[model samples]
Target: MTTATLPARSDLGRPIILLMAVACGVIVANLYYAQTLIDVIGPQIGMSASVAGLITTLTQLGYGLGLFLIVPVADLFENRRIVLGSILVTVIGCLAIAASQGPTSFLVASILTGVGATGAQVLVPLASHLAAPEKQGRVVGTVMSGLLFGIMLARPVANFLAGSFGWRSTFLVSAAAMALIGIALLLACPQRRPRGGMRYGEALASTFAQLRQHRVVRMRAFYQSLMFAAFNLFWTAAPLALIRQFHLGHAGVGAFALAGAGGALVAPVAGWLADRRLTRPTSLAGLAGLSVGFLLADWTVAAGSLIGFTIMAVLIDAAVQLSQITGQKLIFSIDPDARGRINAAYMTVMFVVGALGSVIGSATYEAGGWSASAIAGAAIGGVATLGFLLFDRGASAPR
Candidate 1:
């Protein structure tokens, strides 16, 4: 069970970064397809609205578990094999969903899909590991643009598919895309397994211990967790408010989805900034934007203002995407050799926090109404923003 060691320099080129992004994008998109289609899924499966939220909850949980459990395998196995194997499993999960006849089956499929989709987390490390140290941010950012694009596009794509062929067929379409994407990755990506291997126990021990002891990892993990909590809170409640309060159709929600897509366009720029020694400012700015966005969301929710709410949503999406890239840049800077495990740990914590926020937001929205929920979300996000400002300022002073 020794871990294989890749060469000091991998044969990864710029084209590979682009290809990896596309492949990972398709894979990551699987986890969010349900987000847009829950309206269809809940009724079709006879689940309560509250319970239907579990689709996202369970998927996030599965993803977090996979990040902690499966992603660390990159330290032991070849990147191509790991990526291919995970894609194959993901395909199976997608088929399970397409064929499912009830909520229970689809729920199981969703969890499995999340586990398989963890390959994107592993790919993040592989791309960073392949690039030159000076170019890590740009490479990571390029790949993340694909990831964020997938995330932003998943909703609109799902809306289209659900509108056209019905919900189950959406799963089938994603399955087909996953298959083609997997083959492309198998064909294009270089093999990166090292000649010598470390024992599995040793590798796992090293990673787990690193997570426990690394100050930077701890700080980044907390930073990502808090930011993602805000992200989850907003997404979990926004659609319900749009549909129930405003009476907008799925298409309108899909259109609104584009704002986030537009905001995510900053991912590569954030990555470029991180590489150029602007990590602190980049992170702080993202957090500030998020805090302001949440406050705006709160104001609109209270005032029942549509235009203001939409603007707030766009700002929130942009800010969250920026924070995500900044966090990744910071994490990748730590212990470059353990990029896979580190990223896995980072994403696992973030998703777990997000899942928790989703649960809290949904409950608060249902019980106290959207205004209360908005206030709750803003308060949590406000604290995280303040923490980031303090951290950024500390980094500026002379030792």
Candidate 2:
């Protein structure tokens, strides 16, 4: 696919950006609605905690597969159609999930839902594609902040909706929200058609080739994998800790999750730094923050310090966003024409591992309660920090 820059005022206005952000938040929100609702969804559907991890794992697996299988198609086809079509699939998946009475159907729907959620990923590149070269980071970051809000708010919003109505209501609402969001995106966003020089088969093949050819793609993928893994671990386990350890009801969990969404606020700042060539230092800070955040959570969870737990939880959340924004900015700059494919390779690796995090989060908590989960999260974060520090050479950042 070839690249062309679009004007800021005509194509990339604040309204368009806002719509993109909202669309991204609502679309990606599908992946996370169940993270906090596992407690509620599992018991009603007859799934054990051991098996509950499959909920996130399957969803993430579907998303990873979509990143590799579907996202790169944007390089060959019209961007808007692919995005809207994915949203349609997401709506179907959400409705199926809402209607499911057993684990088999629900799990199947989870995969479908995850596949559909890649609309948000597609939008990330589309937003990047439309912006002028110098402002791509800021534009991408703004869109990403929407994604982060969806991730952060999905838990609380799902909890609140589920608390008032039922667990199924969350998905029902998500399906509806997506329908509206899809239409808004269709109407508001300018259509960008990639020059159709590459075939689907070649685009898919080149996506994999990006990982082998680009060190930045590989290293950034590895880095975000750790951040995402630890991120999934903490958020997945946190609701259980809140309910069992802190004795908070669904409302309380929703409130805490709402507060935690504050962590996503760092995304714009991360993007800004990335634009200014501060990605290297910001990357280090994010990883170190994750390690420290996990340790602090370890202490706070044991002591039943809600204030402390929230602080550390937000820290972990912010650190993950920090790393992600920087990593994405770096990777996107590797090849402007190949942003779609590079992003697919990077996210596929990161999210597949990240999916495992949910499994570990629930299983570890079940096995050893909050302590084991928190420590494991800390260890993962530390390893990421150390690996980056010891192994990363100075020239990895894009020149």
Candidate 3:
């Protein structure tokens, strides 16, 4: 299908994409805010860096649980209500964090925040359902752009706020924003309820059964998990390295993170490529780039050169975003009816891997220094790159 023959904007227009994107961005951003504020929050609550990392770990863990368990409800019930409820839950979580007196409250709040922020996975599938077939890639891409922006920008924004005000203020502001957006979505979006009903057990059984039966889904999920494992490794160590090794302050480290956002801006271009039937090649290319980037980043970090590290940051992040878009495009192609469930399963696995990677990154960095962690991460990416190549062999050829 060519652009000339593409469906009308009414079927998948700028407005719809924009709204979906904003929703996705807002929801997804909630997950990463803790990353930026944790440095500040840790001292305030008397937590160590490793324990602080667990806050993110638990949030990710909660997100994984919510994705597999809660998101499936989108398939059984009306998404508008589910989404509204999720956002409300997020608001509550954020408020809890804002008002917390200690690390325990923050940890619980983080888990709830993760549970509530899963609205993005549901909304992405909803966009795919609403879009014309030929436009699914672009439509998904547009919404993902927002999601990527949220992921990429969350830390920087939180860092900015935390630096300017306090860590608690970040959650208070986020809570208010989530509440406002939840209200707006309730009023503005049209109802999209599930037409078919299935018992909770049936939904769980079917979701797993579908995963077992679908070769494409399994391969895409596996490949994405491996890729994200390495992605999280870098992010987990980035601030620690900057602040400890380079002697940069939180604000400076946050700026370094903001620079990484450059890579996510390519999300739309990745979508266009996938839509034009270049998804497989794009995936392979992205994986290869990520592997190479990891090696370069490892070298830069080991050498203690800020300029080299900065360039590596851009290349590595861009490569990660490209792989992410490619992975989602593949999953989105497999089944529309269960996109949310599929994504939930995929993300649950990946988040688990990511949490493990964060621990690995921190431990490696602390033990053997940046060189050891960077090299290990690069090696992991290389292994995943091989999977990307092999995975493409059995799939439909890219357009």
Candidate 4:
């Protein structure tokens, strides 16, 4: 694929973009639905506390694996078909989870859900492909805002559903929702077949090649990995902290999660900045905000002020979302033809680190409680801030 083969202008009107955004929200929500339900699902399914923590970790692990293995195939096949196929897998996974009777079955279903949820990744790069170069940042940002909101809201929605109807009902409803979204997307999404002539094997091989060849891809991926690790660490631990320290029930946790969704409002702003070629400065601010948010969270927790803690949650989520969009806009600009593979490489690394962050959050919470988790999160943010200042200070924006 070459520049000449690309569309002269974006075909992504507001309607299609809105549809893509909603689809992304529904698709990505699968990977997170179980996070807040761990306590409810684990006990009913006979899982011990220690093993229950693997619920979130395994889902993320499956997603990371799909990013490495399944996402690259987007470059070798019709993008819409791939997304629809992945959604079918998601439907099956959700049904299996709904029917699960034991820990083994439940965990396995969780993995499948995560793998199938890679459909969101497919839609993102597809959005980039359809948008004109100048509008790519704004379009991707808008779509990602949907995805981020899905992530932020999944916890509360899952909690609310579980509290009202039981955890199994949550999975059942998700399966039905996915099926409907898949049918609508199949009817509406424009078919985009990659012009690259690479075979599937070649496409997978080229992901590694892209990592080596594109310095911006590497830098952006590394920067976001650090921020994303902190993002996961905080979310994973925050619920536990609320339950243990504040005596919040599932409903209370759900309300807290809803408050965090406010941070997703930053996605379009970050995208706007990226379109204006302010990636470096915006990214630095995002990193600094992450550290400051965690520090404020630490203070709020110590003061036992829920309002202050919620405010910090908004800041933390906003900062992480900002950095994410900035990195994505930068990477998407590097190669139009390889957006699938580029996204695969970038997201694979970030989510892999994110999975570790979940595990670390659990372990640290068990070891030293909320203070430890906050400190660990702040330290991760500080590392990212230093990396940006020292190594990526003068990085050039993609033209």
Whole-model Cα lDDT per candidate? 0.77, 0.86, 0.76, 0.86
Candidate 4, residues 154-272, lDDT tens digits: the string is 87788778878988999899889888889888877788877767788888889978889988888888878888889889988998988988899878888888898889888889888
So what's the TM-score on candidate 4?
0.93
Instruction: For model 4, state the Cα shift of residue 84 in Å.
Output: 0.6
- What is candidate 1's CA lDDT for residue 113? 94
Using TM-score as the measure, name the better of candidate 3 and candidate 4.
4
Relative to the unseen true structure, what is the C-alpha lDDT of residue 165 in candidate 2, on a scale of 0 to 100? 99
- Give the alpha carbon lDDT tens digit for every residue of 1-399 in model 3: 111122343555577678878888988899998876666788888788878887877888778878878877767777778888889889999999888878888899899999988888888777766677667677777788788778878988887788789877888888888877777777665556555456776776677665687776677766667777777788878778888889998678877877876776777777778888888777777778877887888777778888788888778777776777767777777765566667777777666776677778888888887777788777877887777666557653552
- Candidate 2 has an lDDT of 0.86
Error of 1 at 243 (Å): 2.3
Error of 1 at 351 (Å): 1.4
* lDDT, candidate 2, 305-350, per-residue tens: 9989988878898999889888888888777667788888888889
Q: In order, how many clashes per candidate?
A: 6, 0, 1, 0
RMSD to truth, every model: 3.2, 2.6, 4.2, 2.3
For model 3, which pairs clash?
277-399
Pairs that collide in candidate 4 are none
User: Per-candidate TM vs. native?
Assistant: 0.88, 0.91, 0.90, 0.93
